[model samples]
Target chain A: MQQPIAILDSGVGGLTVAKEVMRQLPREKIIYFGDTARTPYGPRPAQEVIRFTQEIVDYLLKFSPKMIVIACNTATAFALETIRSRVSIPVIGVVHPGARAAINRTQSGYIGVIGTEGTVNSGAYEQALKQLSPHVDVVSVACPRFVPLVERGNFRSEETYNTVNESLAGLRSTRIDTLILGCTHYPFLAETISDVMGGQIALISSAEETARDISTILHDKGKLARGDLLPVHQFCCSGDPQMFKMIAQQWLNEQIELTPIVWQVPHIG
Target chain B: MQQPIAILDSGVGGLTVAKEVMRQLPREKIIYFGDTARTPYGPRPAQEVIRFTQEIVDYLLKFSPKMIVIACNTATAFALETIRSRVSIPVIGVVHPGARAAINRTQSGYIGVIGTEGTVNSGAYEQALKQLSPHVDVVSVACPRFVPLVERGNFRSEETYNTVNESLAGLRSTRIDTLILGCTHYPFLAETISDVMGGQIALISSAEETARDISTILHDKGKLARGDLLPVHQFCCSGDPQMFKMIAQQWLNEQIELTPIVWQVPHIG
Candidate 1:
C-alpha cells in the first residue's frame, strides 16, 4: 500500500480540506491529525504554533506520508516554511493557493480576505497575493468568531448569520469583488457569508485549490497511488477523538475509527 | 548555480509557457527546447510524438533541470505520463492545469477547447474536466491554421483574424462560457480569439497555470533558486535558431542567445 497523504490542523476545521481531498483524489488514502486539545491556535504566539506544528509533523513523519498538508490556516501562517525545511516529503499549505485563487478570480483587482486573527494579522495572504500580483489591493479582516461557531457546529443558526453579517459589515463599502474564505472552517458557513457579500462577489476557498495542488505535486513527483486497491484512511486527534470521528463520519459518510494522540509536549523555553 | 526548469515544445509554441514562467518566476532560470524541425507534432502518430518528445527530453536531461515542463499540448497529450515515469525530477504538463483552470472558470458547465489535432483528438482536456467535474460538457475543436500563423509571426493581420473567426465558427453556437486555449501557441492569438468569442467568454491559457504549478512544485521540493543572483535563461531550437531568437527577443523584450540543437535522429525501426 502507498503511504497515505498526511494532513494536520488545529481542529475539525481541516475536515473541510480533508473532505475536498477525499472528493477529488478518491483513490488515495488520507491520514489526518487534529490538535483539538489546542483548538483556536489563532490566539497563540507564532513561536508556539510553530512548535506545535513541528510536533504534529514529527508524529506524521513516523507514518511515512508521501506528502503532508498543513490544513490549519493559523499554523500555515506561522509554520509552513519551517516545517517544509525540516521535512523531506512534499509539504503543502492552504494560504498560497488561496491567495493564488483569489488573484485569479478577482476582476476589479480589489481582493478581500477573512480568516482567524492569526492568519489575517500574519499578512500571509497579502504577501502571497502581492507576490502573484504586484499592484492588486489586498484587504484582510479577522472573523474572530467564525472558527468557534464552526467548531461548535453552529453553522446554520441565526446567531452565526448575524455574527457573519456584523463581522463582514466593513467590507460592503469596499469594491472587493473577490473574498477569500481564508480559514478552512469558513466554507461551512459559505451560504451565510455569500448572502452577506452578495451574488456578485466570488468566494475563494483554499480547500479545493489546496487539493488540486496536492494532485499536481503528486503527479509531478510520481507519488500518485497506482492500481485499484481498496485503500485505508486514518483519522486521529490530540483531543476529543469522538468529536472528530462524528464529524468525519458525517462529512465522509463512512464509519472511521479514530485513535487518540498523546504526544509528550516538549518544554519550549 | 540552481538547475534550470526545462521546458520542451514541438516549436515556438512552448515559448508562451516559457514567457509566463519567466514572468511569474523571475528568479527561475529556464532552459527551453523547441523542436522546430518537426514543428507540428499535431496529426502525427502518438508513438512518433512520444519518441520525438523522449528525444528532446533526453537532450534536456543533460541540463539537470529541477523540473521538466511539457509545454506543448500535443506533446503533453502524447507523452507526459511516459516521460514522468522515466524521470526522477518533477515532470509537469500543460493539459491538466489548463483543464483545472477551465473547470474553475466555467460557470455554465459548458466548456470549449481549442488545440492542435493531436491534443483535441487525445480527449485529454475532456478526461481532466470530467475527472474534476463529472458533469461538465467539453467541446473541442482543432485549429490547424493557427499554429502555422503563430510560427510565421502573423498574429495581427486581417487574414489571421478571418482565420481565427472561421476556425472558431463552430464554437459560437455551443453556449460555452469558458474556452481553453489548449495549445500553448494559442495565447499569442488571445486578442483575435477573444474578439471572435466576444467579451463574455473567459479564455483559459495553460501558460500562467503551468508556471504556477512549476513554482508550487519547486517550493515543495525545496529546490527553488535561493540566491538573488541574475538568472541565465537558455533557448534552443532543433530547426531555425535565428527565427526563434528574433521572436524570443521581441516577446520577452530581452536579448537572448538561441542554441541550435543537432541530435543524431534516432533510427525508429
Candidate 2:
C-alpha cells in the first residue's frame, strides 16, 4: 500500500491545498482531516489553536502517512513547531512556503500579506520572510471577516467583493508589488480579491505555493509516488457532513470518500 | 564558517543559478566553478560529459559544501544520478526544477523545451515532466547554436536576434502555453526568445526554478543560513579568467572574487 500524505486544517480552508495536491501530484494518495465543528481557529487563542491542531494531527497519524501538511495558516502559525518536534516524518507548514514564494515574486522588496487574526498576530509571515531574506519589507493585515465568508461558500458574491475590496483598501495605498494570500481560505475568494487588487499587484496563493514546495521536498527525498494507477484519496470532517461534501465536491470537481468522525470526548467539539 | 552551496556548469551558464541564489537566499554562501576550458558540453558524448562533471564534483568536494547543484542542463541530463550516488550531500539538478515549474505554470497540457544537443537528445526534460505528470505533451528541440552565442557574450546583437528567431521558428507553430528554458544560458537570451515566442507562452527559467528548489530543500533539512551577515561568494574557471570575470560581474551586477584554476593534469583541460 502506498503511504499517503496527511493534511489537516481548522476547517475546509485546507481543501484549497488538497485540491492543488490532487492536481500537482495525481498519483500520490491523500488523507485529509477538517475540524469544521470547531471552524475558524483564527480568533481563538494560540494555545487553543495548537490543541485543536494537535487533535486533528493525532487523528490523521493513524494512517502512518509519509508526510504531514499543516494546511491552515492559523494552525501552521500556532502548532507547526510543536507538531514538528513530535512527528518523525516531514511536517510542512503553509506559512514558510507562502513567504518564500512572495520573496521570489516581489520586485519592489515590499510584500503584503492578508491572513487570519491568529496568523497575523503570530507574525509568522514576517518572521519567515525576514529569516529567508532580511532586507524584505513586510506588511501584514488580519482579515477576521474573510474566513466566515469562505466558510459559508460565498466566494464571488457581492458581499465577498465588498469585504475583499474594503479589507484590501489599506494595501492598495501601499506600493507592494506582491500580495500573499496568507490564509488558505483566501484562495476561495481569489477572483474577488484579484478584481479589487487589479493587475499590477500579483497575488501569491499559499495553497498553490505549498503544493509546489511539497513536490520539491518529496522529489528531493526520492519519495514521490510512482505508478500508472491513480491512488484513491480519503477525507474526514468533524462537522455537518452534507455541507462539507457539497463544498468539497464543488471545489474538487470530483467525488471523494468522506468519513465524518464523531468526537469521542464531547468537551473538545 | 558557513558552508557554501557548490554550483558547477560547463561554462558561465551556471551563473544564472548563482545570481538567483544570491537574490533569494542572501545569507547563504556560494562557491561556483565554470569549466570554460572545455565549454559547451552540449554536443559532447554522454560519457565525456559525465566524466567532466565528476571531475568538477571531486574538485568541489574539497570545500565540504552543504549541497551540490549541477546547474548545467547538459551535465544534469548526463551526470546528475552519477554525482548524486557518489556524494552524500543534497545534489540538485536544473532539469527537474524546470520540469516542475513548467508543470506548475502550464494551463495547457502542451509544453515546449529548448536545450542543447545533449540535453534534448537525452530526453531528460520529457522524462522528468512525464514522470511528474503523465498526461503532459512535450515538444523538445535541440538548439545547438544558442550556447556559443551566449558564451561569446553576444547577447543582443542583430546577428543574435536572427539566430534566435530562426532557431525558434519551429516552436512558434506549436500550441504550447509554457516553454522551459532548458539551458541555463538561455536566460541570457530571454529577451530575444520572448520577443519571438510572444506573451502567450510563459518561459520557465531552469536557473530561477533551481534556486527556489535549493531554498525549499535546504529549509526542509533545517540547513538554511541564519544571522544578518552577508555572504561573500567565490568563483573559479578553468579557461580565460578575464572573460569569465567580465561576464560574471556584468550578469551578477556586483564585483565577485574569482580564482583562475590551473589544471594539474593536461588531459582534462
Candidate 3:
C-alpha cells in the first residue's frame, strides 16, 4: 500500500529477479521497467548503459518507491555506484549478490563466470569475487550468444544447447566448483547449463541472490510492507508491449496488462 | 556417491525437504531418517504409523541408497498409495517438505487453520491459524506459546516488542497478505523471512520450493549425479549416530561423519 519497489533492466531478463521477489515477498507491489527496445545492454558502452539506467531510474523515482533493484547485471556493473550516489533511497545490484553467493558456494575457490561480452569484459564478477576473497580464482567467459538466445526464447532447443556447449567448452577444463550465471536470463537455461557443468558445480543465479539481497535490505531498513492490500503491479517496456505482455503473463503466471513507455529526452542546458 | 537417497521423519516435520535435498543435490548422496525420537505417523495408531511407514521402509533402509526422498507431508497423507506400490529401492516421508513451505500464498485468502489441541498443543502453529482464519475475515492467533519468541527464545517475553507489536497486534486487525514461517525454528527468523512476511500473518517453509524442488526431482530422475567425483558424504545424528545422522546433519548444518546403522528390535514385534 505504500510505495512499490522499483526494478529496471535492459529487458525481460529482469523478470527473473522480479519473479523471485514476488515469490519471496508476495506482499510487496512492484513497478518494473524494461528497456527492451534497446536491450542486450551487454553490448553497449559503459557511458551509454549508465545514461539509460539513469533515465529509467529518474522515471521510476516518480513512484517514490522504497528501493530500486538494478536487476540487470550489465546495468549493475556499469551504473550501480553512479545510481547509489544519485539516489537517497536504497539501490541493489545483481553482481555483488551473485559474487557473494558464488564465494559462499565454491569450495574449490575456483569460479567461472559467463555473461555477455560487456559483463565479462568489464570484469565485474571477477572484481567482485576477488574483493570478497582475494585468493579466489576467477575465470570469465563472454558468451555473446546467450542474451540473443534468451531474448528470442530459444531455450531447450538443440541449437541453444549447442551454442551453450560450444561457448562453455573451455570452462570444462577449469575445474571450478561454482559457475555464476552472471546474467539474469541464464536461469531459464539452468537445466542445460547444469547438465553441461555437471552436478559438482553449483550454478549461482544472480537473479535469485539479488532478490535475497533485496529482501534483506528491505527488512533491515524497516521498509517492508505491512498491511494486506492486494498489490498493484505495473509492467512497462520500451519495446513491443505485446511480446513483453506475453512474457510477463507467462513468467508471473498471472494475466497481466502491459504498458509501453518512451524515454523522455532531458532538456539541454 | 553411489546409491543413497534415504529419508525419514518422526511424527512428521521433514526438515524442509532435507534442506532442499542438501541445497539441490550437491552430488546426490543423501541418507536421511527423521527419528523425531518417537515418530509421528499421523492419526493412525502407533502400530499402523510404523507398520505402514516404519516396517515397510525398513528403518530408513540403511544401505547403499540410490534415491529415497519422502520428505513427509502429503506422502504420509494422500500419496501413500504410490510409494507403497511403486518401487523396491526405498521410500520417503512427507512432513518436512510440507512444513517447509506454505501450502498456498494468498493475497486475500488470509487462511486460518486450527491444528487442534494436539498440533496447537504441540505448538505446531497450525491449529492456531485455522481457528483464526475462520473468524477475523481470516487471521488466527495462537497463545500456545509453543512458537518460541526466538529473539530470546521466549514466546512470553514482553521485550519481544517488534514481533509482538508488528505481527500479533497488526494481524489482529488488518487483513494479512500471506502467513508463511509456520515452523518455530529460529532460522526462519532470517531477514528474507521477515522482509517477505513483512510482519503479518502465518505461513510455512518449502525449502524444496526454495531450492526449486531439488533441481526438478534430480533432473527428472536421470538420477542426476554426473562427473567430477569427490562425492562422499556420511550421515550421522545427535541422539543415535546410526538411525538419525542423515536427516539430522541435513537438517542441521555441520561436518558429519556417519557410522553404520543397525535398526533396534521392536519390543512389540
Query: RMSD in angstroms, all models?
Result: 5.0, 1.5, 17.0
Q: Top model by TM-score, which number? A: 2
Q: Model 1's DockQ? A: 0.26
Q: What's each prediction's TM-score?
A: 0.78, 0.98, 0.54
Candidate rank order under DockQ: 2, 1, 3
i-RMS for every candidate = 3.6, 0.8, 12.3
Candidate 2: stretches off by over 4 Å: A260-268, B261-267
- Among incorrect, acceptable, medium and high, the docking class of model 3 is incorrect
Q: Name the better of 2 and 3 by TM-score.
A: 2
Interface RMSD of 1: 3.6
TM-score of each model's B chain? 0.96, 0.98, 0.30
Best to worst by TM-score, what's the order?
Answer: 2, 1, 3
- The TM-score obtained by model 2 is 0.98
| Per-residue C-alpha lDDT of model 2 across residues B1-269, encoded as one tens digit per residue | 88999999999999999999999999999999999999999999999999999998888888889999999999999999999999999999999999988988888889999999999999999999988888799999999999999989999999999999999999999989999999999999999999999988999999999999999999999999996889888898888888888899999999987865535423567
Residue A46, model 3: Cα distance from true site in angstroms? 0.8
